[model samples]
Target: MRRILAVLLIAATTASAAAAGQSGKPRYFVKAWLQKADKTFEHTTSWCGPDQHCLVPIGEDMIELRELSGSSYYLRFISASSEDTPCCVFRNGSREARLESEYPRVATLYYRPEIWGGRGVTKFGRLIIVVEDLY
Candidate 1:
């Protein structure tokens, strides 16, 4: 039937994409930047405080991210298995780098109005300026 054909088509595409990538651990990254409430984009962490105008100052360990978390500047990566979906690192507020892959499929991005765009954070204090795809 049409449904079966469609399912086969999708599986074929995914297999093709997986094979195209290099022989290594499958991984991806997300990029974003930190913006002060003063409307200025701060590439590096500065005098940002947790309960002040800036919550993430320079050298602050951004362990907690949108969907990823770890120690200091680097995050942990978990490989995918046949029974589980692939994992990704949400590299938020990183303006210099972007996430890319040779694979044809990828994760979809969306805006979180209730979190950063709500009141504090970017609207009133500080925020991690992540693009739609980075979040």
Candidate 2:
């Protein structure tokens, strides 16, 4: 009886640990950019693929962009759905202007138009995101 009880306890502990790990949210890379005139431009196309896509929070979403100088920027939005499609926005200080939408799922070619001044080819860039499963 003692041996049986010990085995059951160990099994329970292992099951709990597995459950905890599964409950943790998964991390994903989200690529954001603009598309214009049937052209797409951006940097770091890690997450824009057929098997991979941007993961958005079920509720409110917050994204932070960190620069090489250690400075950061924040973007907050609600209802970022998978069916809503992907796009990029240009930032000018506190003002954010939407550039364009409708980008290829995984293609890494083409050039996205620059919405903030004639800054050559403006690639908004990529960001790592942790999305919570709000079932």
Candidate 3:
């Protein structure tokens, strides 16, 4: 009876682990480019697996994405917002780019400096982010 109970417990644990791994969560590989104080760019890469949220750090700020499916993604830009500088995507140093879909694509974000805010160009310059699905 002891041997049978031990076997049953092990089997149940294994099945539960398998079911957790089979959960519908997706995984992602991310590459990001952020500008430094000297106007140069820096590259950072990371992975967002099923065990954690998809939060990519760009310098001191962070960008989060959720429910990424097809051409739709929910995005959030977290930065030092005391300056009230809005974060947006820029193209070719001039034109702005939309932060929409298509896997393995590049999106550049620009944080403009607030003229009257004391933050003094908090998170300035361009931030480029690339996302690839690894599920």
Candidate 4:
């Protein structure tokens, strides 16, 4: 009877610890460039994947995306040239990528958020900026 109680206590402790770990995880977001060749696509902020590429104009307001999780994200790009040409790009990660094999590019940009969670106060209001090539 004592042994069973001990085991139950251990299991409860373990479960609580796991839940705490998950809650402690900081929320994340990615800022990436939707288009490669467009100079107007260059910008920076908290709205991109850690491994994704970023393209923005030389001088423009930097727009960012926030609240990204589980290796997947929703990408919406407002065309710098045409307001009527806004595009929505759904970028996902490796884990979520397996869900859709047809569009390989739709996979998430960052694989591990813990490794690339970025710096500063990530919980309340934080932003991580990364620049790369999407090729």
Candidate 5:
């Protein structure tokens, strides 16, 4: 009985969140700025929502970032989905890696920091800076 209620509650919350995302409320955005070898930059940005996959392509790979309702966020690499290879990672402002791991990690930012960002590396060792905004 308790388990059923929990499942139902989660389902209801997710459905409402999906609706809110389409309602034009302040949504989360995942922006990427990839530096090329010639010093030029390639940019891409996508809005995120609960249970939705927002992909920003970098070279042949892609950085996947999404928000869970308005509560938390998730980050990972699409190409590295089935492998243990580290394709991307969240980092602090100082360029120090923060949420580094061999696999995807669900990041729950209850405090809603202004910026929860990350970086992606291409096959040529170029840099891709990805920023996830709280609002």
Candidate 6:
């Protein structure tokens, strides 16, 4: 009886974990680009995945997508708004991206002042926008 109960518990736990992983979520692993909101500037984050040369422009917003060590992805936004800039995420089909903080400050994302567009010309402070997960 004891052995049976232990086996059942382990099986149940494994099934639950599998279900969680199978949850429908978008996983984006591709190469993309970004241009500034103004015609005065434009940049890219070295390529999210492949440098196959099919570079596509996302917009004039100084931003890029990167994969985290945790197998998640995030968006890097350049802004200087202490008021917290809120935005939503959208993609063509399967690639999913979710906005992090509805109330974002400069440190909301990954802030690297040393990077290009790190010193954004926004009246607001450098915004460290964080996007949650490819899942």
CA lDDT, every model vs. true structure? 0.27, 0.28, 0.50, 0.27, 0.39, 0.30
Model 4 has an lDDT value of 0.27
Candidate 5's residue-wise lDDT over 1-135, tens digit each? 535533333333332223323334334544444443346544444445434445556445566654433434355544323343333332331222233222222221111123223233223223333343355
Candidate 3 wrongly placed segments (more than 4 Å): 1-26, 36-38, 51-53, 80-123
lDDT (Cα, tens digit) per residue for candidate 6, span 1-135: 534533333333332222223223333322222222333322222222222112213233444444443233345443332324432222221122433322221222222323324464232122222222233
* TM-score versus the correct structure, for each prediction: 0.22, 0.18, 0.48, 0.26, 0.35, 0.22
lDDT by residue for model 2 (29-124), tens:
333332233443222212211222232221233333222111222333222325333334433323222211222122122123433345555443
lDDT of 6 at 94: 19
Best by lDDT: 3
Instruction: State which candidate, 4 or 5, has the greater TM-score.
Output: 5
| Candidate 1 C-alpha lDDT tens digits along 1-111 | 535533433343332223323233322222223333356432221121122111222122231222322111222222222323222223342222232222121222222
lDDT of 3 by residue, 9-87 (tens): 3333332222223334447655555554458654555556655446666556676777764344555556644655455
Q: lDDT of model 4 at residue 129?
A: 28
Which of 3 and 6 is the better model by TM-score?
A: 3
Instruction: State, as a TM-score between 0 and 1, how close model 1 is to the true structure.
Output: 0.22
Q: For residues 1-135, could you state the per-residue lDDT of candidate 4 as single tens digits?
A: 535533333333332222222232223322222223232223222322343332222123323222233443333233333333222222332222222111212222322333334332111111112322222
Order the candidates by lDDT, highest first — what do you get? 3, 5, 6, 2, 4, 1
Candidate 6 residue spans exceeding 4 A from truth:
1-25, 28-59, 71-124
lDDT of 4 at 21: 26
Against the true structure, candidate 6 reaches a TM-score of 0.22
Which has the greatest TM-score?
3
State in Å the error of residue 104, model 1: 19
Better of 3 and 6 by lDDT: 3
